[model samples]
Target: RVDFTKIVEEQKSLREDFNKLREDFNKMLLEISELKKGYGRLERRIESTFNAMISGLTDLSKYAGLTLEDFTRKILENYLKGMGVLPSDRSLRSETIDSEQIDIFCEDPAIVGEVTAYAESTKEAEKLLKKASVVRQKLGKEPKKYLLVMTTNKQVYKDIQKISEENEIELIVGRVV
Candidate 1:
């Protein structure tokens, strides 16, 4: 006599295994999707690196475009006037340092503030650090904090945070507008 009932149970086990295989396939598909996403990110990094390595950018504004000094002045004036950071007793001299300018120079009771503003770029973090170093050297004592405002792009917010944390400097960015 053939054990048909036992054969049916084996078939049921085989069907369960098939379902498990389908779930594994779906998991593999998700992993593949994630890998593709990561690869695309890497491709973008390579492209940006290549562009950075290229020559100077052409001027559309005929050399009348926004300069770093202009940006620094605007940001400092707004912060001092609107934010009450500037003092009437002492003159406020705002300048951009090659390094983070040792934040302390910006904080002297008589010195008002030292700020560096940029339009935001890959070079921002490095520039901020440089300003910090200069401020430190100039002040002999570290300033309370370094204020960095970027009018160019807010995409570098995370980068600003990272550098600020690493250097223990206060980094502020301009609004998206």
Candidate 2:
């Protein structure tokens, strides 16, 4: 016959093990909660940092009276410079190519860019296409052509996208205030 006392002892041991497991699970939950809190704090800090940077940039823009077009032009120039265009090449001092105001023209990478504040009409895309054609003629048929617009509606943006694709122009939209 089996010893009933031994069976009772085994049950007690099992209960102890289950209690320990419950305690460990609770501890893990608490640790996860603490980690979530820490992550929340980190996320807020990052958001605040970006907001401050944007505010600083906005203040500088206001001080310089930079319109949307001007701001976009500046961004294009900086982007070209970042792409390895020299300061002298990216300078606005360069004469307007073909008696038309070309936005950004870098000889090294052979890129010509145009900046517009708004592109809400199909006519805008057409004009940009014409400009790209001229730039291609000047910079050669294979040079990179870009049109950077500050804002556009969804429908108009689609139109512009089609035109750019057909004309082999890179249409970039900048979401800037």
Identify the leading candidate in terms of lDDT: 2
Per-model TM-score on C-alpha atoms = 0.39, 0.52
Task: Tell me the lDDT of candidate 1.
Answer: 0.52
Candidate 1: stretches off by over 4 Å: 1-78, 81-86, 94-107, 110-122, 144-147, 152-155, 175-177
lDDT of 2 by residue, 1-177 (tens): 268988999999999999999999999999999999999999768645543553455446667888644665565566556766546444432236677666666555566666666676767656655655676777675556777665677788888778888878767764323
Candidate 1 lDDT over residue span 1-177, tens digit each = 268988998899999999999999999999999999999999768644432321112122126575544444444444455656656443344554553333223445423233443545536556555655566676666544544453445566666667668767555454433
Q: Assess candidate 2 and give its lDDT.
A: 0.66
- Steric clash pairs (candidate 2): none
Let me know the TM-score candidate 2 reaches against the reference structure.
0.52
Cα RMSDs, all models: 11.8, 9.5
Q: All models: lDDT?
A: 0.52, 0.66
